[model samples]
Target: MPDVACPESPVTPPPPDTHTRSLSRTLPISVLLFTVVPLVIAGLLTLTEGAQRLREEQELRARQTASLLAGRVTQLLASAQRLGQAMAVSPAVLAALQPPASADRAMDEPPSRPEVLGDPWLALIRSFPEVDRVELLDAQGRKVYTHPPRMQESPPVRHLTASQPPWYPREDLGSIEIGLRVTHDGADGWVVVGVSAQSLARALEPPAQDGGELWALLRDAQGRVLMLVRRIAGQPPEVQPLPVIEALAAPDARSRPVVARSALDDSAWSVEVQASLDAYRSLVLAELLRFGLTVLVISALSAGLAWHFARSLTRAIREVARAARAILRGHYLNAHVALQRDDELGLLAQSFNHMSRQLEQRERERDVFGRLVSPEVRDQLVQGELMLGGQEVEVTVLFSDIRGFTRLCEGLKPRDVVLTLNEYFTRMTHAVQRFGGYVNNYMGDAMVVVFGAPTPDPHRVERALHAAVAMRRELAAFNQERASYGAAPLEIGIGLASGTALAGQIGSPERCIYTVIGDTVNIAARLEGLAKHESGMQVFMNQATRDLLPPHLREALQPLGELALKGRGTRVPVWGLPEGAELPEPPAHLRRPEEEIL
Candidate 1:
């Protein structure tokens, strides 16, 4: 074919084979989305529901077990009470409560073998498997007779008068005495019974394979646990009282009636049950297996679907990723991804554009904030600036107040007063900053500044004194300037003190201000007040600041010896500087004992 002259046109490459590999990638992604995702979600739900059900079942089982065990203990307690009541009615026990015929015999005298009441009582107690020991006490709480004399002296018995009945405290078998009123039986003494805790423990033993543990305790109204028995073989029998559990026991309706009480003595007894969680271990294992199988099946299906869906999703994601990389490289306006779908992908593009705008806005705001606060301070705030703790630091605090700001404001327009004050602050702030002090805050016409904060300066006291002097001098110069303008000269009183203070940002997390709190700041404020009180001085330095300065500098300054300050118990030595004196060197110590100076 003859070559024909063709119109000039750019050769366009065939549509970059968009469909050639599209199906290849889309198929796997579709399979993953349809199969694996649903399976995984189903498995998670199954596992969660199964675990919850297992917990509920275990809790219900525990409650049931505790109730049953508590019932058994209740029965045993009731039996013990019945036995005690029967003993009260026994003629022999009643006879034992009477004083012996030979009242002349010493209380400790052993009853003649034939006359002793303990032998018969011992015989009777032995007949009952639960009675470990029995004893008799006289009105004086002395053990007149015991089945077995285990010790040289019975542990001191708590005296039980006619008003108090003889009954065992349910918690322990420790030496307990209860009075049996002789009046009821036509006698003039009391009888005490001591039962062995071991016998009670044996009596209250629970069934062997009951799947729960049971404990029996005897307590006084005070809720002391005197005896405890556990169903578990290897567990030690506990005799110590459980106050917390006992408190709960009394308040709970289900537990109150079952917890026994002795009618004769008014002593209380209780039982506790704790079901073993292991009781339902088999059920849990079975449910767990079912959960695991369901999870495995669902996970397999979900993963497959996810893998297939991921392939198609990756195409749109890759486009966004490529544009993001371009934007990160500083091509802010040169890069954008085409999000053709009206789904999450399109929303993401919109969000990304919004994020770009927000990021620019933040940059501008940061610049403005930097101007408002010092760069270092702004950085600290933005970067979690502090450890949120206070520290004792050597700081020089300065308090300055306009001498007659309120009076001056009355004469001038409000705007004029504000303008003049603003001008004053500008000059004072510049001076303070020059001396490496931070203006802590402005309180109406007063300004508080701290040296050696945020960052410490070794010569903080000297710097603060220098700043205070400079501030007064600047005020004079400002007043002179105002005088030329036909305005009254402004005067300010300044106070400076140096000492240890707790300095840090103080307030809530949402709003906080850096400040110092301590006796030093208070003293500085007091000195400022004193400045107004002093005859010819506008600045007052407390003994603290005066002592901090060198002796030569101290000599140059005029001392206002021992002036009493408000709220101070004793007079404080104060000093003032002449209108013009060279700045003094800081003393080694702000305070020294009078003897040391001598």
Candidate 2:
């Protein structure tokens, strides 16, 4: 049978709307969210907590640095005090501090022990570079001698005590000077030392560690910034102000500057330590950036993998859908899906392919089975409705035979005879099936057709008569085609009868066929032989079939009084169609091409 394309099957639902999101797009999104969202949230939380802890640590460090610097300053002052006491009691300074031996001796004259005092004072200055200068004062608290001899003398120390040192500001040098009284061996004098503010600031600065910056400043009792030290990462120590450093920072950069303060004991001075938060800030930012990059990479990989799998899955599904549609359109042979995979989808594909192969095999068997019997019987058998045993049915049987088929075969080769029969049978079968009849048997060039056996039809007799007329017309066209081929034309006679007959599978289990066996079938074959002998008739029918035809078709039948013999107990009445009778137009498929007629 020709394949009929069915756009949509009644049993198959329509596909989803195109606007709906496909698995390919939705899968990646789902996977990205499933994988990346938590990572990003966790990263943000880690960064936040780490930054907080880092700031706290830096602040604590700053406080510790401030306390350390305060203690260091106290130590430095104590050490200086000890050095001054040592120098004050030394013989050279005591001698230098003594009054001039006589009034006559010029007061402007240098002390006799000036070299001794100068040498020790210079050595002290060399040992403690923080000390800029040293001076000697007399018991009257007057400045008398100085190392690296000053051009003019300054006011001497007042209220100097042996137990407590006195500190005085040196405005000219941006420093402070302290006086230590000497009482050893009744030497009443003071040894004064000058301390550089810059040196003090450098001494108080903390060491660099972990990429942080520490800024230290020495403030006096008046709150003046006497000295400032800046220790920044990737740079040398500087003395720039806090405002300048802040201005140089990026606008979006964030840092928590922690300040710690400590007082210098007995000096009315304080040290402030400020720690830069940018060190840990930069580290946190770098970590955040790395985390962000990791998240992006993971999300991208997840999306890519999801897309790949979704594409493979959807592609396989589409292939299966296409194959299923092919099956619905009756193209069983073409219904197949090709997918190479090891996953569940592969298994599905295998199952679908196996199903399609089974369908194709069944279709092939159906076609081969259809060739042996009529398509109607094949359908009945496929539907499991036709029984193995015979059943009585009111069947209208039409029997047709070629008048000179035996003579025609004698004149042709065996191959030619077979081809001729095939062509002739092909047209006849089409005519018979067109009117709801199926060829039950083919006896050489003769065909026995039945209607209303497997399927009941009230118009079975009318349909059988219509089929007889259609066959007569098809034979005329067949003769025309033979004439075109320069072959001899052929003739045929048809006989139809309607009666209760045995109809069903009528053979052994090894090889079975569906056919009818009754007087009606015998009578139809006898009428076909009788038709050829009639002077002007092409078709004959018994009384039972003629009576069943409608009025219009009944009026067209010519009366043929029956004279029957073989297997009949009584004479039977028959009706015939005269040679000159009107042959109705052939079945609608007559207009089809010769190839299609097959």
Best lDDT goes to which candidate? 2
Q: What is candidate 1's TM-score against the reference?
A: 0.40
Model 1 residue 265 distance off true place after TM-score fit, in angstroms: 14
Which residue pairs show backbone clashes in model 2?
Answer: none
Model 2 is weakest, by summed lDDT over 10 consecutive residues, at 1-10
142-162 per-residue lDDT for model 1 (tens digits) = 655555555344554536666
After TM-score superposition, the amount by which residue 236's alpha carbon in candidate 2 deviates from its true location, in angstroms, is: 80
* lDDT accuracy of residue 523 in candidate 1: 83
lDDT (tens digit, per residue) of candidate 2 on 345-376: 67667777777777677767767776766555
Query: RMSD, each candidate, Å?
Result: 19.2, 33.4
Report how far residue 253 has shifted in candidate 1, in Å: 29
- In order of appearance, the predictions have TM-scores of 0.40, 0.48
Q: Residue 36: error of model 1 in Å?
A: 8.6
Q: lDDT of all the models against the reference?
A: 0.61, 0.72
